[model samples]
Target chain A: MTTLVLVSHPQLADSTSQQFLKESLPDDDIIWEHIESLSSLDVAQEQAQLRRADRIILQFPLYWYAAPAGLKQWEDTVLTRTFVYGDHRYPLADKELGIVVTTGMPRQAFQRGGAEGVTLDAALAPLAALAHRAQMRWLPVFPIYQFGYLEEPEKLQLVVDYQRYLTQPQPDSLANRQDWFAQRLDGMVARLAEDQRTTGRLIASVFEQNREQIDQLHDTLAMIKEQDDD
Target chain B: MTEQSQWLSQQIDQLAAQQEKFTDRAFWLALKQVVAEQDRRSEQLGGEVDGRTWRPDRW
Candidate 1:
């Protein structure tokens, strides 16, 4: 089957990191659909690409904890009801949906009780739910963290990690499925399919995996914040 | 027992037992490799999920 990589970066040509990673894709049978100039995005052409591919991959740099404006627009225009989410069903149903999120902060900050005190999983809920609503299964998100400043080796490793994130089996394991509870607001995740719902259970289980570590991390953050108050 | 459930249980047990090793270089590396492998194979099968698969040469 062919893999369709739908990429959008405000200034991809300038992003050496993103540029390098984008070039590492398989050439044959892989559809490379990029939005270099969003001003000329013809809805027809974009939908044609999404309709032809077996997998619809949405990739973007994390802008304010979500997709860039172009990606958001793509999601809005291309994933329309009649064409994608209508009575017959969205075209992307059963298609593997994955997101590659690159961040400058430590990966720990994106998860609950991280040193920075913000969890990525929680921040990405709207995106995940959006995919879930489309009935497009969500593969574990691939994150490139601690990237504000990096050495050559760090950059190479980040690229490799990106590649692996795209190819990995059992992507679910990568997600800290344990926090489905600790972060729960109500019957949110519980509403997913039995198969999908396990995500929360798994996150909760992960929370149990390193109970002490997470708690300690939170405690340290608390202490630091308390000190700052004084 | 269903293989999926059993496999997940085994993994949970393995992770639970290897508590002290969570922060170790070996565990993270192993987990990274596993996630990639799983996601890649699912693509091969054209699973209902949609994801991107890029190779090193492409970059």
Candidate 2:
């Protein structure tokens, strides 16, 4: 599936996190647009790019707990009612809207009892509302906290995870995340030597057990929804 | 096994340990706590800096 990543960091060239994330993304099947680099906004061209994408990611560093003015302007200028909302002609319907946000503050600081006194989800509520208004599926927020301080190994892991977060199919649910980890474990197991196969088997067994619990949780959630419908 | 494979194994082991204590309600809460603690010490050490004049382009 084609993905459109609209990078909105005003100083993207200097952002360690954004630069690393850009480098990590696969060159094929993904279109990268630097919103701040646009000297003049071309509405039709922007809409055309959105039309071609199956998923649209708004990547930005958190500025005063919201996106920078550049991204906000793009939304106001491009996502017009005729294209996004009214008249039963939602061009973005069935597409996914994802946000990739970075913060200099620690992750804990954005929670209810934390220093920020609000969760990241609450902070980015406007973006989620925008996705809802446009009839798009809102994916989970991908947060990179304190990017400047991360070590090499953590940065490497972030790169891999960020790539998967952008490209992975299905909504961000516990079950889906579990399945992704299980799939990775399976691949690792397959590459192990015969002598190391025992460890692989143990890990697989653990994963299978966890999968059962996740499945149970999914089923319970579905049953609750069914009851609500009835 | 390769270095990457070894790291994968370690991660699998950690996941297994986590699964044993898993509960939907507590999982999210625990995750939030862990994230909060990651940079707490560093932040405390540095204190809060004034960001009013901090331009993204300048940084």
Candidate 3:
């Protein structure tokens, strides 16, 4: 599926987190749109881009607990009533809306009794509501906290995970994540030399065995529930 | 096996051992632990942790 990442950082060149994320996303099926550069966005062309994308990600550094002015402007200008919410058909219907936000403070600071006193979800409620109004599925918000404090290894992991998040199908579901890992394991096994296959098989076997046990446990729970009801 | 593969295999073995006596709670705990380890390894390998999904009701 095509993904459109509309980045709205005013000073994206100076931001470490935004730069890293932009660099990590797969270039093939993903389109990157810097909102600051779209001051004169052609409504038809922009609408066409949205039409082609199955997922739209709003990537920005959290500014005063909300998106920068550029993104808000883009939304106001591009998502007209006729295009998004009028008698005309909604071009964004059934499309997924995802938010990628970066913060200077640690994640804990955004919780209750913390410095910010408002949860991240509370801060981004408007975006979620906007997705609802536009008939789009609101995916979870991805928050990068204290980007400057992350070490090299953490940064590398973030790149890998973020790339997967951007490219993987049905990324919000746990089952899909499991499938992604399983597929990766299978691919690794396939590429192994003769002597290395044993280790790969061992790992795959563990996953299979654990899945079977989990399934059996689920069955047992179902049976117990049935018995209790009867 | 390469060092990375060996480390992964070891993790699988540990997870398998935990699975043998897995209760519902144990399963969830094990899953959480595995996810934590993956995050830790990612950091060790110079990878960053991606953002999480946020729902207002959960707060």
Q: Which candidate number has the best TM-score? A: 3
In candidate 2 the C-alpha lDDT for residue A219 amounts to 59
Question: Lowest summed-lDDT stretch of 10 residues in model 1 chain A?
Answer: A177-186
Ranking by DockQ: 3, 2, 1
Regions of model 3 farther than 4 Å from truth: A26-28, A167-173, A188-201, B1-59
Per-residue lDDT of A1-230 in model 3, one digit per residue for the tens?
89998999888788877877776775448999998976598888888999999989999988889999999988888888888879657789999998889898898899999999888899999999889988998887888999899975466557645655666666545445545555555654555456656755776665555445444554555665575476
Candidate 1, residues A35-83: lDDT per residue as tens digits?
Answer: 7566777888888776676665677777777778888787777667777
Model with the higher lDDT, candidate 2 or 3: 2
Clashing pairs in 2: A108-B36
Q: Count the backbone clashes (under 3 Å) in each candidate.
A: 39, 1, 15
TM-score of chain A of each: 0.65, 0.76, 0.81
**Cα RMSD (angstroms) for every candidate in the order listed:** 19.7, 15.7, 11.7
lDDT tens readout by residue for model 2, A1-230: 89999999888788878887877784348999999999999999999999999999999999999999999999999988888877788889889999999998999899988988888899999999988988899998999999889975566467556766777677655445555555555655555566566755675664565456445544555665575476
Off by over 4 Å in 2: A172-230, B1-59
Residue A166 lDDT (model 1): 50
Which window of 10 residues has the lowest lDDT sum in candidate 3 chain A? A171-180
Error of 2 at A225 (Å): 21
lDDT of 3 by residue, B1-59 (tens): 33654566565444434432222112223333344444444343322111121325546
lDDT of 2 at B17: 39
